[model samples]
Target: MVDLKVKLGSLELQNPVMTASGTYGYGEEYEDFVDINRLGGIVVKGTTLHPRQGNDYPRMAETPMGMLNAVGLQNVGVDRFISEIYPRIKKYRTNILVNVSGSTVEEYVETAAKINALDHIPGIELNISCPNVKEGGMAFGTSCPSTIAVTAAVREVYNKHMMVKLSPNVTNIAEIALGVESAGADSVSLINTLLGMAIDVEQRRPVLSTITGGLSGAAVKPVALRMVWQVAQAVKIPVVGMGGISNAEDAIAFMLAGASAVQIGTANFIDPKVTEKVIAGIEDYLVRHNMTSVAELKGALQA
Candidate 1:
């Protein structure tokens, strides 16, 4: 029998197929279309110490093969998430990882501390890589110094597994990955949407409110795969690959590239059942390849 289980830091996922934050609400929203328990992990929407209204409308636009979005970081503050959302998802059989973000280091640490208090939540995905926001998001993720400081600060209070999400908008992504890994980050997930923009020629205006948004979908798969490969080779910790992953072949490709696991983002919007399908496809691929476990595929690239 093939084993699909994968480990991220101290958390053991049933499989590598997890729903990315923001794409999948608290896991309850897709209950009708997806079997939440079947997923390896569920990363809840990005949360801050306080609530955020997010950016203005016209936050999303369609590009050639991908989509651009500037959703800001709209989320019910951590308090509300714990009191309201937590109770609902705490019972899921899979690991429930909270995607934490903030405007400042203190806020990030404080938020991480709060999430640490939740006994049911096994881990937190630190999102210093959100491009839609003006303040904290990508700013912290792009700078190696800020990456080290914020992660180390949160490490003090957050006892559970902590995964740092790296932004694609950077000069040296691999360097940033190494910095976070050294700063007590248990793991790192990468290629958080690339910065992009769309324009309306006739209207003579930008498509999104922020004028620029994070590009995601099939268009980003190659870039995501390359970045994942680079960071995975550079860091000792596991790397969670994401960006434009839409099917099982894409997930497998990431695994082969060196990602210990992967997060399904925009694909969830297209097909809520995509996670289950990817899981099944992985199994089929394993069988066809005569592999016994998914772990064997990590960094298995022949070239």
Candidate 2:
């Protein structure tokens, strides 16, 4: 039998497939469509320190092979999530993580501290990479010093595993990864979303409410792979590679490129059962190759 289990920081998974934050609602939303416990991990939707209305309508637009979204960071905030959402998802068999986002450093620290209070929540994926918000969204992620400041601050308060999400819009992704590592981040999730804009020729205006939104889908796989490879080589901490992962092949590619694991985003909307399929597919790949463990594939890429 093949051992598909993989280690992500302090968390262990039956497999390496995880549902991306924002794309996968608080784990319970897909109970009818998926077996929530089967997933290696579930990252709940992005939650801020306080409630946010997010951006206006027409926040998502489809481009060739991908889509752009500016959904802002609309959520019921941390308090509601702790009181309501946490109690419900805490029972899941697998790791249940909160994807925390904030407009400022203080908010991030506060939100993370609250999540840390929850016994069942094992970790948090910081949303310093979110490009949809107008205020303190991607700013904290792009700059090295700012990344260190925010991550270090949260590291001081949150005791559990902290995964800092990295923005792909920056010039040097490895530099950002190293910066977060220095600040006490347990692991880093990279290639959140590429900033892109769609145009409506007939209307002669931008397609999204925010004009430019985070681009995701098959189009970002190459870039995501490159960044993941660069980061895995640069930093000692494990890297969670994401962006345009549609199937087991994509997930395996990421593992081979040195990603400890991967997250499914846009593909979830196209098919709610995709996560299960990817998990099964990875197992099949291991069996076919006569590999006993999934960890063997990680960073196994040849020069």
Candidate 3:
């Protein structure tokens, strides 16, 4: 049997396959379609210090090879989530991580501190992609100083494993990754989504309510892979790669590119059972390659 277990700093996962935040809802919605206990982890939808109404309607648009989304990180706030959502999902056997987001450094720290109190939540995927309202709407992950500042602030309050999610809109993603690492990130996941926009030519207008949105899916895989490779080489912390992973091959490609694990996002919308398939497929690939452990595939790229 292949050993699929992997260590993301102090957190050890059953396997390297996990459902990305915003894609998998609190591990309850997909209970019927997916075997929650089988997954390495489930990153619940984004959670904030306070409730958010999110963006206007028509926030999502389908593209050629992917989709554009401007959902605006709508969540039920951390207090309500701890009281209502946590009890239900905390019973799951696999790891459950919260995707913490905020428009300011204090908000991020407050949200993360609350999540850190949950015994079942082994870690948090700090989403620094949210626009910093105090900084003229610039995303916290885009600038090195901002990324370090927010990550360091959250790190002070959050004692558990901290996995910072990197945004792809930055000029040098590796530089940002290093910044987070220095500030005390246990691991880093990338690339969050490429900035993109869709338009309805016939209507002579943009498709999404927000003119621009984050682009994700198959089209972003190559870019994500490159960023993962670069970040993996740049930081000592394990790298959890995500963006557009649809199958075991795609997941394996990220591992070979230097990712310790991978998260499934847009593909989860298409097939709720994709995570199960990927776990099995990874084992199959290992057997075919005469390998024994999934860990062997990390950074095993020929080039």
Give me the candidate number with maximum lDDT.
3
Choose 1 or 3, whichever is better by TM-score. Answer: 3
Point out the higher-scoring one by TM-score: 2 or 3: 3
RMSD, each candidate, Å? Answer: 1.7, 1.7, 0.6
Q: How many residue pairs clash in each candidate?
A: 1, 0, 0
Candidate 1: where are CA atoms >4 Å away?
130-138
lDDT per model vs. reference = 0.91, 0.90, 0.94
- Across 1-303, the per-residue lDDT of candidate 1 in tens digits comes to 899999886899999999898899899999999889999999998999999999999899999888999998899899999898888788899899999988888889999999999999999999987432445345888888888888999999999999999998898899999999889999998878888999999999999999999999999999999999999889999999998899999999999999999999999888889999999999999999999999999999999
Model 3 agreement with the true structure over 1-303: per-residue lDDT tens digits = 889999998989999999899888788999899889999998999999999989998999999899999999988999999999898888999988899999999999989998888999999999999999999999998899999999999999999999999999988999999999999999998888899998899999999999999999999999999999999999999999998999999999999999999999999999889999999999999999999999999999999
Ranking by lDDT: 3, 1, 2
The model with the greatest TM-score is: 3
TM-score of 2: 0.97
TM-score of 3: 0.99
* lDDT measured at residue 108 in model 3 versus the true structure, 0 to 100: 95
Residue 97 miss distance in model 2 (angstroms): 0.8
Clashing pairs in 3: none
Error of 1 at 207 (Å): 0.7
